[model samples]
Each structure stands twice: as structure tokens, then as C-alpha cells.
Target: MPEIINISDAEDPRVAPYRDVRERDLVGREGLFIAEGEVVLRGLLDSSGHRPLSLLIAEKRIGGLADLLERVPADVPVYAAGQAVMDAIAGFPMHRGILGLGARAPGVAAADLLAGLPARALVMVLVGIANHDNVGGLFRNAAAFGVDAVLLDTTSCDPLYRKAIRVSVGAALQVPFARLGAGEDALDVLEAAGFTSFALTPSGTLALAQVRRPARTAVLFGAEGPGLPAEIMARCAGVRIQMSAGFDSLNVATSSGIVLHHLAEAIA
Candidate 1:
């Protein structure tokens, strides 16, 4: 069993990092992110790419985590408190009662991530997607469809944000991702790496049923309203999801799921 240091005061310095989590959140904590709930915590524990720094768990729920705690490093701190105290620290209801502080190497360059992919690969590229919920949902879909990695343009939001991690059920940690710098040509990078790129949009010239899955594919999606930039779409093969005549629009996440599922079926 991991050592459980009982914390009664919400102001305790040891648990300070977890305070005001929802409103203020732990910012600039040197790449550390809060993994909440049993599912997210389990993902943190299972992931080798990211490491849990410590844990802040509700005292009443400690028994439920015995098997999980065994996998945690012995040196990491496990701070336990009552539900009320946990609620006070989080500045929220604290219903989930489980949280882990974890870290991963931050700011992986898109080129470095692309260079490491296998010859036959599937990548989901995001351009100008700033919403945390959408970012999380994309990662979830990417993982579900066996995407090799997700590449985000400089305008995209960080998937490590607390809300995003929670919303993704921790897939942001499970699915590998790297962010591109400003002016970086992600399609050119993928093309040079031998990937045929597809731009998904409602106005796409090619029908979804006409797509020929490539050995290595990179599917690009943009933020909902603006969608993919015309120049970028023009550079890649454009494919559209067939939808009801009146409803050409779909949530970005929903559209990604539909497209990825179709592509996944053609995987060799």
C-alpha cells in the first residue's frame, strides 16, 4: 500500500497545488496536469509516456484504489482528505474524489513526431481548434479509430488542460500528439513523410464514398465555424461526408468520428 498522508486542513502546503482547481487551475506547474476520476487516474497509471507525480484522493475512497496504488511509485506522495476538505480544495463539489498530479514532456515539435511514425500510419491533424472540449473529443475519436498520432497547428489548444483531460476520459494522454509551430506546413511535412493527406469539409469536391485509403493517411479537421482554410484544402484531396440536404454542418468531433470510422474499416 502507498503511504497515505492524512490532510485535514485545505490550506495544507502539501496539497496546495490542488486548490481552486476548476477556477484557477494549476498553471505553469512545470508541465504537470491534473488527472481526475477513476478512469483518468487509471490512464495515468497505465501510461508510460507520462508519470504521476503524486495523488490527492478522498479518504473515504482510499480502499477503492488499493490495487491501483500498488502500481504507483513508492516515493510519490498520496495525500488523503475527507470529502468536505477535498471539495474546499477544489472549489467544487469534488464528486469524483480521485485526482492525480502527472507530467509529460511538453511541446513536442510536429516534425519530430512525424519523423517517428511508421511507414503505414493514420494521423488526425487539427487546425485552429481552440476549444478544450473539442480537443478532447478529437483525441477520443483518434484513439478509437487507431490514429497513429494527432498533430495540431499552433492555433490549437493544449490537450493537457484539466478540463480536456477529464472530457477525453484521459485519451489526451493515451493518444500521442504534437503541436506545430506558426507558419509550419503540416501537409507538406506529412507528404514528405509519404502520407496522402485528406481535408474534411462540407464543401469538399470529392464524395466520402470515393476516398481511396492510402497506406499512410493524415486527415485534417479545423475549428467548426471557419472549417479548413481553402488554400490548405486545395492543397490536399478534399472529401465530404454525405449528410441530409438541409444539414450540411456537423460538430467537428462528430464529423471526425464519422470520417475516422470509415477510414478505419479500410485499414490493411
Candidate 2:
């Protein structure tokens, strides 16, 4: 069992990492990330890709989380605080009263992640997806469909963002992801790995359902309004979801789920 420390003061130096979360979230957490709520914390404990540094919980909630706490590594510090102190430390009311500070495992290059995949594989590539909620939703969908991995362009938001982790219900922690190095082209990597890349776009030349699933498939999604760039789509096979007359596109996250579901069914 991990040691449980009691925190009476919000400013206690030991708990400084959890202080002013909102402010730190804007500025970035150095190498650490905040995992919020019971579900995300549970995900943290279960994930091998992230290491939990510490946990902060409301004193009242400790009994309920005893079994969950047992899974935490012996050396990790677990801190308990009253609701008021918790709120003060976080600079907001933490109703669920569970927060974890975690560090991501050492970075894996995009090429390495792709090379490690089995012969038959499915992956998602995200480009310029800045919205945290959308990024989270994409991971949740990717996990649901058993995607081999997710590759993000450098412009995308961090999946480890607190809100993204909460939004994904911890799927972000479970899924393997790597961002492209600056100036690296996503298609070049996929193509070199023998993946048939499909760019999802409103003006795609072929309907998504028409294309046969490839042994190694990589689906590319871009930001909602702009969708995938024409140049990028030109390099990959353009695929579209059939929609009503007036609607040219769907929300990026929603579109990802639909596309992933189709591909998953094909694989099944």
C-alpha cells in the first residue's frame, strides 16, 4: 500500500503540483499532467504508458477507493485533504475529489510505433485537430474500434491535457499515440510503412463504403471546417461518408467514429 499523507493546508509544498490547475493548464505542466476524477485516475493506474507520480483525494472518499488504491505502486505518494483544502489547492471545486499527477512514458517516434504494428493493422492520423474535446472523442472512438495506434501532426493538441483525458474517459491513456516531428509528412510515413492511407473529406472521389479494407489501413482526419488539405488528400485515396444533400460534412470526432466503425466492421 502507498503511504497516505494528510494535507491540512492548501499551500503545502508537497501538494504544489496540484495548485492552480487551471493556470498551470494554460501554461503547460512541464512534463506532468493532471488526471481528474475517479475514472481517469483508475485509467492512470491501469495504463503502462503513463506513470502516476502522486494522487490527491478527498478524505471522505478514501474508504470508497481502498480497493482502487491498492493497485497503486508502493512508492507513489497518496495525499488526502478535506473538501475545502482540495478546492483551494485546485482553485476550483473538485466534486469527484480525485486527481492524479502523472508523467508520460518516454516518447516513441511515429515510425517506431508504425513499425511495431502487426501485419494487419488499422490506425488513425489526426492533423491540425486543436480542440481538446474533439481530440478526446477521437481517442475514445479509436479505442472502441481497436485501432492499432493514433498519429497526430505537430499542430494537434496534447491528448494528455486534463480535459482531454476526462473527456476520453481515460481512453487516451490506453491508446498508443505519437506526434509527427516538425516538418514530417504523415502520408510519407504511412506509405513507407506499406499502409494504404485514406483521407476523409467532403469532396472525396470515392464513398467510404466503396473502398475495400486494406491489410494495413491508415485513416486521416483533419480539423472540422477545413477538413483534410487538398494536397494531402491528393496523396492518399479520397474517401467520403455519404450524407444528406445539404450537409457536406460531419463534426470531425463524429466523422472519425463513423469511419472507424465502418473499417472495424470490415475487419470483423
Candidate 3:
């Protein structure tokens, strides 16, 4: 069994890092990512890119994590506390008794990421996607549909955000991503990387079925309400899914799934 530290006081400085758990992003500290639920926690620990600093396991549910506990590094701290105390620390209930703390891996630069990628790759790029859950789902869908990487453009939420990590079910931990600060810069970077960027838009002139699937493709999606910026879409190749005219556009993540699925098939 891993060494367990019994935590009694929620205000203890030793547990300070875990305090005000509900509003963690507002904590002002950088590079911290939280994983909740045993499945996601285990995924983070097992993934090569992520390393957990510690874990807060509910004392009542330790029995459920016997196998995972055995696999955790002996040196990693396991803070065990009663349900009420755990609730107090996290500022909520129903965490499934397993939360892991880990330092986020340093972000990879877009240039370096492109240099390291295989000659032919498929990347999913998010444009102005603000919802963390939607961003997380996009990562999950990208991973599932054979996207080689995820790129974030202006206004997109951080994929490593705590809610994003949990919402992605840890897929964010495993998927490769890099943030591009501006839309113009993102397009230039993709071009320099030898990637053909495709913007998915409802008003796109070409149907998705007609576009040439390149050996290297980057698919870009924006949020639902505003959709892709007209200026941004003008700078890249454009394609839209053929759906019923009366039906509104798909959610950004779902559109990404559709694009990635087709791209995966094209690549295969």
C-alpha cells in the first residue's frame, strides 16, 4: 500500500495547494492540472507526457483503488481524508474519491511540434472555441478520429484546464496540442510547416466531399454562435459538410469529429 497522509484540517498549508478546489483556474498559479475520477487519474499517471505530484484519495473509497494505488510511485504523496473533509477541500461532492495533482508538461511550441511531426499528419485546430467542455470533447474526438495533433488558435480555451482535463476523460493528457496566439500567426505557421489548412464553415463554397485530401491536412473549427471568422476562413482552404439546409450548423466539436473521421479514412 502507498504511504498515506491522514489529512484532518482543510486549511492546513500542506494541503493549501488543494484548497478552493472549485475555482482552481482562478488560483492564479500556472502549470497546474487536476484530474478527477479514478479512470482519468489513472490515465494521466500512465501517460508518458503527464506526471502527477500527489493524489487526494477519499478514505471511504480506498478499497476501490487497490490496484492503481499499488502502481503509483512510492514517493508520490497519497493524502487520505474523510468524505466530509475531502468535500471541504475540493469545495464540492461526488468526485468518485480519486483526484490527482500533477504539474502540467511544458507546452510544445508550434514550430517545434511541426518539425517533429511525421511528414504526413492530420491536425485539428480550434478557432475561438471558448467552452472548456467543448474544447475537451474536441480533443477526445480528435484523438478518436486519428488526428495527429490539436492546435489552438485565438480565443480557444486551454486544453489543460482542470475542467478540460476531466471533461476529456484524460484524452487531453494523451493527445498532442500546442497553442497559437493569433489567427494570422496560426495560418502562417501551418503554411510554414507544409500543412494545408482547411476551415470548416457553413458558408463554404466547396463541399467537404469535393476537396482534395492532402498528405498533410489541418482542419480548423470555430465556436457555434460566431462560427469561423470571415477573415480567418478567407486565409485558408474552406469546406463544409453537406447537411439539410434547415438544420443549423453542427456543434464545433461534432463538426471536428465528422472532419476527422473523413480525414482518417482518406489517410488510411
Candidate 4:
């Protein structure tokens, strides 16, 4: 069991990393991130690439989380505070009563990540996806479909963001993801790994159902409005989901789910 320290004051220095979570989220947390709610905390504990540095929970929640607390390493500090103090420390009414400070492991290179995958694999490549919700949703879809990995371009937002983690329901923490290095092309890496790259777009030359699933597949999705750049799509086989006559596009997250579901079904 981990030691549970009682914190009477909101200004306790031990819990400083969790202060003004919303504000800290905007400026960034150096190498640390705040994991909110019970579900996300559980994810933080289970994640291999990220480790919980400390935990802050409302005193009332301690009894309910006893089993979960046992899973935490004995060396990590778990702090408990009253409801008012918890709210004051969080700069809001934290109804969930659970927060964890976690540190990300050193980033893995895209080449290393792709090279580590098995012969039969499915992966998602995200480019210029800046929305936290979309990034989270993509991770959720990736996890649901058993994607081998997710590759993000430099312009993509961090999946470890608090809002993204909440929206993903902890999937972000479970999925293995890596970012492309400076000036590195996603297609180059996928192609080098013998993956058949598919660029999902409204103007795709072939419908998603028409193409047979490859032994190794990489589905590329870009930001919603602009969609995948024509140049990038040109390099990969263009595939599209059949939709209604009027709608030309779907939210990136929704598109990803649809595409991933199709790929998963194809494999099954």
C-alpha cells in the first residue's frame, strides 16, 4: 500500500504541480501532465510509457479507491485533502476528486516504432490534427480496433493532454504512439516498413470497400476542413468511405472510426 499524506492547506508545495490545471494545460507542464478523474488515473497507473509521479484525491474518495491505491508503487506519494481544499487546489469544483501527475517517457523515433511492428499490422497516421478532442477520439478508435500503433506528424496535438485523455476514456494512455521527426515524411517510414499506405479523403479514387486489406496497412487522416494534402494523397492509394450525396466530409475523429472499423472488419 502507498502512503497517504493528509494535506490541510490548498497551498501545499507537494501538490503544486496540480495547481490551476486549466491554466497549466495552456502553458504546458514541462514533462508532466495532469490526469483527471478515476478512469484516467487508472490509465496512468497502467501505462508503461508514462508513470504517475504523485496522486491527489479528496479524503472522501480514499476509501472508495483503496484497491486502486494498492496498485500504486509504495514510493509514490498519495495526498488526500478535504473537498473544499481539493477544489481550491484545482481552481475548480473537482467533482471526480481524483488527479494524478504523470511524466511521459522519452519519445520513441518513428522509424524505431514502425520497425518494431509485426508483419501483419494496422496503424493510423495523423497529420495536422490539432484538435485535442479529435486526437483523443482517434486514440479511442485506434484502441478499439486493435491498431498496431499511431503515427503523428509534428503538427498534431499531444495525446497526453488532459482533455484528450478524458475524451479517449483512457485509450490515449493505452495506445502506442510516436511523432515523426523534423522534415520526416510519414509515407516514407510506412513504405520503408512495407506498409500499403491509404490516404482517406473525400475525392478518393477508390471506395474503402473496394480495396482488399493488405498485410500491413497505414491509414492517413488529416485535419477535417482542409483534408489530406493532395501531394500526400498522391503518394498513397486514395480511399473514401461512401457517404450521402451532399456531405463531402466528416469530422476527422468520426472518419477515423469509420475507416478503422472497416479495416478491422476486413481483417476479421
Candidate 5:
């Protein structure tokens, strides 16, 4: 367990980074990301690649998190604040008292993430998914379905966003992920790596069940309204979840859950 440094003041310099968390999208860009809740914090501590800088929790909730606390690094500062102070610092009422600040180990590359995977991998690829909540939900779905890794194009929202991490229930911290450049070169890379890429869309050429089982599969999901780009669809096998015609689509996250669940069954 770590030493519990008490935080009585919301403006205390030691707790400065946590202030105005929702506003900090890391747009001005610090490599740091905050993980919320004990479940998410536990995920951060358990992940070998994501290193925690510090942890903060409400004083009243400390006892409830004893086992989770033991997993945090001894050197990491574990700040404990009272309820009022916690609410003041967060700018809202926080039912879940745990928060962890984490960063990816420096110099980690897409290739490195790709290289370590098992021979048969089931991955999710996202493009133009700007909504943090949706992005977070997709990550949660990916984690639930035992996805091997997640690859995001330039247009996707950062999975490390605080809201996304919270929505994911810490799946963002648990899952392996990497980013691709603006171009569609990643598709070619996937093909070279023996991945059978599938672009998911409502008008997809084949129903998901109809497609042959792929040994190493990567499913591409795009933004909610526009869906996957035609160029992207052209680059891979097109797959659709069989939904009723009256409705145009399922929520991106919900569709991902359905697709990945089916894929997981095939993977197993």
C-alpha cells in the first residue's frame, strides 16, 4: 500500500493536474491521461504498459479500496481528500472516489504493439470516431469481446480522454492500442501482416454471419452518421450486422458489441 497524503485544499499544487479534468482534452497536449473509478484505477495498476504517475481517492472510500491500493506502486503518491474537497476539485459530485493519472511508457511504437501480439489476433480499427463516449463504449466492447488490439486513425477521438476512460470502465487502460497516420496505409499494413480486414457498415456487401471465418481479423468501424468511408470499404471485405430495414443503424458502440461478440465466438 502507498502512503496516503492528505489533501485538505482543492487548490493545492500537489493536486493541480486533476483540477478542471473534463476541460482538459490534452488538446494543448500533455502525454498524461486520467483514469476514474476504482475499477478503472485497478485496471491501470494491473496493466504493465500503462504506468501510473499518481492516484487520488476520497478519504471515506479508502478502506473499500484496500486490496486495489496494494497493487499501486509504492513510490506513486496516493492523495486522499475529504468529500467536499473531492467534489470541489472535480467540479462535480463523484460517486466513484478513485482516480489514477497514467502515461504510456515512452517511445512505444505501433510496430512494437503489433509485434508482441499472438499469431492469431482479433483487432478493432476506428476511423473518424470523434465522440468520446462512443469511443469509450467501443473500447469497453472490445475489452469484453477479448480483442487483441485497437488501432485508431487520425480522425478518432483519444481513448485516454477522462470521460472515455470512465465510460470504458477502464478498458482503455487494459487494452493495447496504437494510432495510424492520416492516410489509409494502415490497411495495407494489416494486409501485409496477414490480417483479413473487414469494414463494417449498414450497406455492407455481406452479412457478418455469411462471411467465412478469418484466422486473423481486423474489423473497421467508422463514425456514427457517415459510417465507413467508401475508399475504406473498398480496401477490405464489407460486413454488416443483420438489423431490421425500418431502422438505419444501431449505435456504433452497440453494433461493435454485436460484431465483436460474434467474432469472439468464431475466434474461440
Candidate 6:
């Protein structure tokens, strides 16, 4: 077990990194990745590319964290504090009772990712997605649906943002993502990789069940309001989910789940 430093004061400089977590997203430019709950923490630890920098646990919850503490390197700091102090330091109620700070995996080049991609790969390309939760949910869905990789467009939000990482349930750490340089948009990059681009849109020309599966299928999606850029949509095969009326569109993440699930099943 790692040495458990008892924290009595919220102002302790040693724990300052955990303060005002809500605002940390704005004040911190380099971005911070957080893994909450025992399940997510274990998942992050299992990943080869991610490592925890430190951990904070409510005094009452320390017992449940024994397995995690045992797995993490002894050098990693594991601190214990009362509920009040934990709440004050985190700037909110710490329901999970345990949180881990992990290093963000460095961004990779899109070309490099695709070059090594396997046959029958399913890739998710998110474009102009601004919402952190949606991005996180999309990552979760991508993981669930067996998407081999994720590619982010120039306008997408940072997937490693603290909130995003928390919502992804550590799936963000598990998924391999790379960004394209220059004008190589998500659709263009997929095309270059011999992947057939499938855009998820309400006004899409083909329904989800109608499209033929390609050996490599890269699904492109965007945020709710604007949907995918018109130019980007022009480059891919347009497809829509079969949905009921009264609902204009699903949240980008929800739409992604449906598309990825069906596509993954098709591929399988």
C-alpha cells in the first residue's frame, strides 16, 4: 500500500491541483484528465498508455480503494482527507469518494493511426463537437461498439478535458485517437485510408439499414445544432437513423451510439 498522507486543510499546497475542479478546465490550459469511481480507475490503470500522477480519496472510502492502491506504483501519491476537506478541495461533492489524476496521452498524427489500422476497422470521426459530455459519451459508445480508433476534426473539443474524461468512464484513455494535420478533414482522411465515409444526418439520403458495409468504415458525426459541415457531408455517404417524429434529432452522442452499434454488428 502507498503511504496515505492525511490532509486536514483545503489550502494545503500539496492538494492545490485538486482545487476548483470546475474552473480548472478554464484556468488550466494544458488540460487535466481525471478518473473517478473504482471501475473507471481500474480501467485507466489497465491501459498501457495512461498512468496516474496522484490520487485523492475520502477517508471513509479508503477501505474500498485497497485493490487500486495495491496496483498503482508505490511512488504515486495517495492522499486521504475528510469529506468536508475533499468537497472543499474539489469544489463539489465527491460522490465517487476517490479520484485519480492521470497524464493525458499525447496526440498522434491521423496518418500514423490509419497506416497501422487493421482490416475491417470501424473508425469514428467527430467534427465540430463542442460539448465535453457529448464527446465523452461518444468515446464510451465508440468503445462499446468496438470502434478501432477515433479521429477528431479541427473544430472538435478536447477529449481529454477533465469533465470529458470523467464522463467517458475512462474509455477515452482506452481508445486510440489521432488528429489530422493541414486540411485533411475527418472525411478526407478516411477517404485517403481507403475507408468509406458514412455521415450520420437526419436528412441523409440513405437510411442506416440501407448502406453497404465496407472493409473499413469511418463514420463521421458532428454536434447537435449544425450537424456535420455541408462540405464534409458532400464527401461521404450520407445515412440517417430510423427515428420517430417530434424529435428533430438525437444528441450527437446518442446518434453515434446507434450508428456505431449497427455498424459494428454489421461488421461482426
- Cα TM-score per model: 0.96, 0.97, 0.93, 0.97, 0.95, 0.93
The residue ranges of model 1 lying beyond 4 angstroms of the native Cα positions read 25-29
lDDT of 3 by residue, 1-268 (tens): 8988999987766667777666887566578778889878888877777788899989988887889999888888999989888888888884688788888778788877877789889888888899998998898887788787888885888887888877888889888888875535877888899999899998888788777678788888888989888887889878889999698668777887887887777652
Taking the tens digit of each residue's C-alpha lDDT, what string does model 2 give over 1-268?
6679999999999999999887876885778999998988988898978999999999999999989899999889999999999999999998989999999978899999999999999999999999999999999999999998999999899999988888899989988999999988999999899999999988889898887789999999999887878889889889889999985658898999999999998862
lDDT leader? 2
lDDT by residue (tens digit), candidate 4, 130-237 = 999999999999999999999999999999898998899888888889999888999999999999999998889989888777999999999988888888988989
Question: Which one wins by TM-score: 1 or 2?
Answer: 2
- lDDT comparing candidate 1 with the true structure: 0.88
lDDT of each: 0.88, 0.91, 0.83, 0.90, 0.85, 0.83
lDDT of 6 by residue, 35-124 (tens): 777878887788777778888899998887787789988788988999999999999998888888888666678977987889878889
> What lDDT score goes with residue 259 in model 4?
89
Task: Give lDDT: candidate 6, residue 17.
Answer: 82
lDDT of 5 at 178: 87
Which candidate order results from sorting by lDDT in descending order?
Answer: 2, 4, 1, 5, 6, 3
Ten consecutive residues with minimal summed lDDT in candidate 6?
26-35
For model 5, residues 88-148, the per-residue Cα lDDT tens digits are 8877887788777788645344556667788878889998999999999999999999998
Candidate 3's displacement at residue 109, Å, is 1.3
User: What is the lDDT for 204 in model 3?
Assistant: 84
